[model samples]
Target: MRLFRSLDYATDADPNWAGSLLADGTLPSFRGGYVGISALRNSDVLTAVSIIAGDVARFPMIVEDKAKETIVPLENVEYLLNTKVNGRLSAYQWRFAMTVNAILTGNSYSRIVRDPLTNEPSMLEFYAPSQTEVDTTDPNHVVYRFTPYNSGYTIVCQQEDVLHWKFFSYDTFTGRSPLLSLGDEIKLQEQGIGTLKSFFGGGLKGSVLKAKGKLSADARKKMREDFERAQSGAASGAPVVVDDTVEYQPLEVDTSVLNLITSNNYSTSQIAKALRVPAYRLAQNSPNQSVKQLSDDYIVNDMPFYFEPITTEAEMKLLDDEQRHKFKIEFDTSKVSGPSVQDVASMKTNGIIVGNEARQKLGMKSIDNPDMNRLESNLNTIWLDQRAAYQAAKAATKGGDAHEGNSHDDNAD
Candidate 1:
């Protein structure tokens, strides 16, 4: 009832928690330092994130006028993106791959590298900085350093000259990787997986052997060799009864191994939630959740938030005054979720979109017919029959009244 009554939740008052309260966020990692993007690939959850990001990044980003809602190309931004980014990666690959890497590591960098002779920037060069250092003296100036792929040396550059994109940052300026949030659990899971594998794979601790008699170190090594010799591709790793020089008694830790496996499987959902993805999408089943609902959640929540930081940063850093006024970049979410059956029916019934439009969206070619663009007359004639009958009766009555006046005038004459 009084959860927020005090900020001090723990009585132990560990410095870590106290420090987090004052600091914007804390860096958490499986090791002493930050987990590299390459290292995160070892995780199933992180792999799923890359898959999801690929799906999102394939959807083309179009420049449009906010007022007209029509596509506008500003200085070949769309064309440049289509061919390649900074002349290194295709638009699709760069946007999607970099976004996935950014979500996992909370870092993406692009610089406005200019031609030497001209002051204007000729092209953009994107870099994935392995590490960055901020000059405390000047808040605006920060440095990014990373090694080029297959290069022996590291390249260092300034942040002001680069376009920085990130996700899940506590402070808007510096993004923190969401992987760090579950770093402790991930480390535990990593160890658990290793332990389970070792137990099954006849690793060092496969079993605790109890020998019958005092054996020399040479005898013990021979016994291990025989055990491995018989265990290759076999259903079981039980020790072979050879010479009776040693008797092995295995540890009864089956229950512990089973529990660890179950926990690891269940944690798939936790990882999916942290990445803002539905568990079901990652091949993890969720009872009572339909495909449509999960797909809706994908477009509604996952995709937008995934692109929020990128769009915001690009708008602020990339756009000049004139371009900002006339053009803006947006991902067409229509690629993610199309109109549902009920939605399409409603749109058709209400004549909101024409037949050609619907057909085109449904992947069918348009028909060369006049009615394809317009709603059928029957759609607008639901109440017209009754209204027409009432109008006919009223018009007849007026005509009879006019004729009666003519007859009365003739009688007077």
Candidate 2:
């Protein structure tokens, strides 16, 4: 029942150390590596990451057949995937949360609850691993101890039902969090922002106070108080009198002096790259061409890495062998789906895709024709029915010859 606020996996924990904890039956250290997930998320970098993932996951999907390679309209799988991934949340909302969690922690999990009588899956519950312990011997085995999810409840879900979506697992059961990999970049961004706030909040740069002549203790105290008074009244333009003996020198730092701005941009771009988000997603001012390129990268290059893995897992896990061969689970990106007109034409020319199929992409009706298999090489024109054309030509030629022979017989008579 524990609501997991953050990831609590032991990625860098030593084997011997965990063994000692087990021997003593003490809780292992829940030390999140430097820049814990909670802290990083609280910072600004995650805003872009979450938005990128959430934007992509918003497109709910349609189930397809693997063997037949067509879509299923009203299957139980559709209802489960769309209307309810969990009892409380719809598939879209749960999916959006999963996508955000995956990007943030590089890992996300869901438990599959089945009907008691039917033994068919009933709901998918996203549990926080606050009390869940991983079994080292069997990497796939996870022992979940429910805190408040259910009182006095313990459950173990195998590989089949639980969806452990991950990013960059690094040859281990625990997927390596991008936050860990891009730790330095995230720090740079966080520290960079912190430095800016500290500087601006003071409304003054670090400065030195110097006197032309040595002052008495009373004079020093008076000077200090006067300086404080001036700072307090800075907004009101309060005037302060400085004697010839005293001078105030300010220390300033322009960004160019330290390349601070460039460093900030570098850090921002690095985090974006690691999360597979395009810079423009973070509100960067990019050209249309660059935007187009990034959009292409998103759909063609980045999204499939995770989606296909789950889809492939669905084929193996969600269905029986026969159903697995006949059915497939897919995330439809048709919202972002595209190709240039020329490219679409080329696909038709190459027979990679067809006219009616392409038309459906734009929400148009299928072309009207019974001869679906007939080939029409000229894409500029409608699909030609060759058999009908040939039959008409043959009939026209025979009638012309008969008319000429009849005319010659009439002339002889």
RMSD of each: 9.9, 6.8
Worst 10 residues of 1 by lDDT: 1-10
Worst 10 residues of 2 by lDDT: 22-31
- Stretches of candidate 2 exceeding 4 Å from the true structure: 1-44, 139-150, 203-208, 214-226, 229-237, 249-255, 258-263, 285-290, 340-413
Clashes of each: 1, 3
Candidate topping lDDT = 1
lDDT of candidate 2 over 1-413, digit per residue (tens): 13222334333422343433322123222323322245345434566656655654665656665554446563566677667776588887777776665655555667777778856667888754343444445555544333435556666656666766666666545554565556576666667677777767763635667986788999988988777776764553345456677787767667573466434577766666766667667655556676667787787787786677566655665566666656678777654666666676677666666666555444344556654333336544433577677768889999999999999999999
Counting only residues 3 or more apart in sequence or on different chains, how many pairs clash (N, Cα, C under 3 Å) in candidate 2?
3
Prediction 2 TM-score vs. true: 0.72
- Per-residue C-alpha lDDT of model 1 across residues 246-356, encoded as one tens digit per residue: 556555665765675756665566677777877777678776867877787778778777766666566655566676777777766653466765675567667777776
Q: Pairs clashing in candidate 1?
A: 110-163
Q: How well does each candidate superpose onto the true structure, as a TM-score?
A: 0.66, 0.72
